[model samples]
Target chain A: MHTRTLAELGDALAAGEMSSEELTRHFLTRIEALDPRLNAFITVTGEAALEAARAADRERAAGRAGPLTGLPIAHKDIFCTDGFRTSCGSRMLDNFISPYDATVVRRLKSAGMVMLGKTNMDEFAMGSSNETSFYGPVRNPWDLDKVPGGSSGGSAAAVAARLTPAATGTDTGGSIRQPAALTGTTGLKPTYGRVSRYGMIAFASSLDQAGTITASACDAALLLEAMAGHDPRDSTSVDAPVERYADGLDRSLEGFRVGVVEEFFDEGLYPASAAAIETALDVLRSLGASVKRVSLPNLALSVPAYYVVAPAECSSNLSRFDGIRFGYRAENPRDLADLYKRSRGEGFGAEVKRRIMTGTYVLSAGYYDAYYLKAQRVRQLIAEDFRAAFAEVDLIAGPTAPTPAFDIGAKTDDPVTMYLNDIYTIGVNLAGLPGVSVPCGFADDLPVGLQLIANHFEEGRLLNVAHMFQQETEWHLRMPGGEFA
Target chain B: MALTRRQVESIANLARLQINEDEIPAYVRNLSRIIDFVDQLEGAGTEHVHPMAHPLNMSQPLRADEVTESDDRARFQANAAAVEAGLYLVPKVIE
Candidate 1:
């Protein structure tokens, strides 16, 4: 049951081959036995999951089943799940139970899907590696010593290890794609506002968007179809029609023009990873997609601009955790200001604190013009560069990460080096475009990913191209030989 | 662009985070490194570019100002650290 994708699991439920209870139980048991090895989950809602699964079985029995009926999936702890804890991988919310379900959680639950649990993530989705998670880092399923790329690492790890067939992830500057690349899972970040952000915790609200991680593009498509739609509560939610993502998976890719970002192939990329991406491009060509080298020259500017913009927004967004509301509060305080300082100081982890301070510095009165406003202008240049490139091609392709997963502590000493992990993935978010990472092949016996990016809201075409390449390659099917496997 | 320890401390103070005295140096180092790294943006000329606040240049969507929500303050405040009679408890701002 854990091996089957959501689609196959749905089919089995419809065919009465297994009840949702049994399937949910199987995954719950796997998580219990396997998650300690990965720390992939922050909380497991076994009892609630079983109850939901039983209800799904009843739905199927009554001929009221949907495509996602009886399928169990993990929600990243960032999303608010009414009766469960939504930790967002930070101690600030460690004891905070959400009062309402995030829009994504509600939609999936409505489709008769059972929530297995909430997977861990970097605190407030800030770090490149899961190491910053207040719960402790999620280890890569491929190799225990290697870090799972983050802040969506736990979701990628959970899906890759088949702990749950799929999970939700949020990407602000490659949180979804980088981890998916490093852990060898399929991850997608839809266009900005394609999925409602009403209840997902804000981390750089403009750059933050909810996405999906799964074993294959087909499964990602399946989950995204259920999660995508406008919400009145989310002011930025796109008031456009949601694509039938799964239905578009079989679209033919004949004569598709794939723009290969020439800048992404420069010296920083690892050779073997480059080789794997080249092979994946050939597979796309075999499917009748032609590759052309297109440049988004302003690509180099995104990381710096993002460092400014993301933190600035986060500093403002996180101000709500001032020891007065739903999050952690100090036991006692000398004064109101002391209460605010102590509560936040003890509640948040290091990376989050550093970002808060960085944001504070950038948005400070004297520095605002030099950092915040300046970065926003550079952000415009980056977006315009993408708009220009999209005019010449239907999609863009590149290596998801410069290299495969690094050893857990390899780059942690220097924050800048750690930030570079998202070098290829951040530009997509800066431009508010949709992108997906598909397992292409392995480098140094570790998985490599080919990132496919499309213009705003072209997720159907992007998924179709990925599905076509995946049909010709078996990389996505290669399960890790970690403890669970 | 290397920030002094005094400056780092002041930044943390402004952010309402109490950094331990021993951890202050690392923050200074890391923050300085980050500032220096992002200094790369200084080279990009954007004299005429408009600073973007939204992606895709979409203006803020406007809708009629009307109450569409029923009161849920009680349910919403259920997760608060402290509350009394439907009011969130906080350190007194006035004596």
Candidate 2:
């Protein structure tokens, strides 16, 4: 039951071998038993989930179920689910229950999927490691001491530990992919606007995207099919038609053009990560992919540009929580200014405040052009670099991180070192393209990931490629040592 | 581009957050590295390019201005540290 994919569970549910209630109970029991050690969930919606599961069972009995009907899924804490506390992993929102559902949550519920719980994440989705989570750092199930890479770390860790079969994740600057890489799970960040952002707690609005982290590429495809669509509520939601992601899972990779970015491998990559990438390339070549070297010369500057642009946007987006509208407020304030100051000072964690301060500084009156405007210009150049490279290659490939899971607190003191963890994954976000992290091999007893990046709205192709590679390898099937606790 | 300790304190105050004096050195050092990294953008020369705020250029279609949403004032204010009726309570200003 722990290792079963969503498709298999759905088939079992359809065949009358298992009821959604039973599956939901099994996962709930597992979460209750293991979540203390993992800290993967912020809020577990047991009653609501069981109620949804029972309803799903009845719907399936009526023969009105969709592909995801009767399946259990967890949401990142960032997505607002009405009646459930959507904390965004911050003290500011610790007690705040959403009045409405995020678009993704609404769509998944409409598809008849059961909502298991809300998973933990970095406070306001700020950090690379899950360490910045105000709820406490989520541990990698593979190794209890190492981090499960972050912002989406709780979602990745939950799925990997079988606390949930599949979970929703949001990526702003590699939050989903990096955690997925470290936890030995599959995560996909669709093209910006491919999934609606309505009701999702904003971090950096321009770069944020919602996707899935599951056991397999096929599972990701199933969730993506249901989650990807335009919503009138989200102004930035793309109106393009979503493709049948799971329908083409068996597509042959023969004659597929896979481009390996030279800069990704040239500098700042760990030797083991480099070797795992090379080995994955060999696997792709064996499967009939024509591997070639491509260059995105300006790709090296992605981390720097992202720090400016993401923080600037975050500072603006987070200003709405000023102790007057919603969320936490300071006690016994002397005046409105003190109320604002003490509330924010107490509510937000260190990293979030650091980013807010940095953003406000850069976007201030005297420094806008030298910082914000210049960063945007560099952002264009980075986007153009991907545009030029994609013309020469169908998909880009590289190591997801410099190495596998680093120990917790190894890079905590140094923000620059922590930011470097997203070096390979950040470029895709800057270019507004789709990217995924699939388990390729293990380095130093930890799982390493091979990143697959495709052009905008190319999610189907990216999943197809990932499915082909997964078909030839069993890495995605390997579970961490534990009997589903 | 490196910020002095005084500048860091000023920025922190401007953002309405309180940081300990001892934490300033570490924050200054780390923020300086990141600022230096972003300073490279000065060479990119973005004179005429419009800042692309979003990926898409289309505007969201507007609907008739009807209230599709009901005010959940009670539920929303449940988490506030202090509240009265439907309004959020805070320290008075202009007294």
Best by DockQ: 1
Give the proportion of true interface contacts each model preserves, from 0 to 1. 0.84, 0.62
Which CAPRI level is candidate 1?
high
DockQ comparisons of all candidates to the true complex: 0.81, 0.61
lDDT per residue as tens, model 1, A1-485: 67777788888888889999999999999999999999999999999999999999888888899899989999999999997788899999988889899999999999989999999899999998999999998999999999989999999999989999999999999999999999988999999999999999999999999999998899889888889988989989998998888898988888899999999998999999999999999998899988999998988888999999999999999999987878888887988889999999999998999899999999998899899999999999999999999999999998999999999989889989999889999989988999999999999989999999999999999999989888999899888885767
Candidate 2's DockQ is 0.61
Q: In lDDT terms, which candidate is top?
A: 1
- In the range A197-271, model 2's lDDT, one tens digit per residue, is 999999888899999999999999999999998887887888889999999888898889999998898668889
Candidate 2 residue A335 Cα shift, in angstroms, is 0.8
RMSD of every prediction: 1.0, 1.6
Q: Candidate 1 — which residues are off by over 4 angstroms?
A: none
Candidate 2: give the clashing pairs.
none
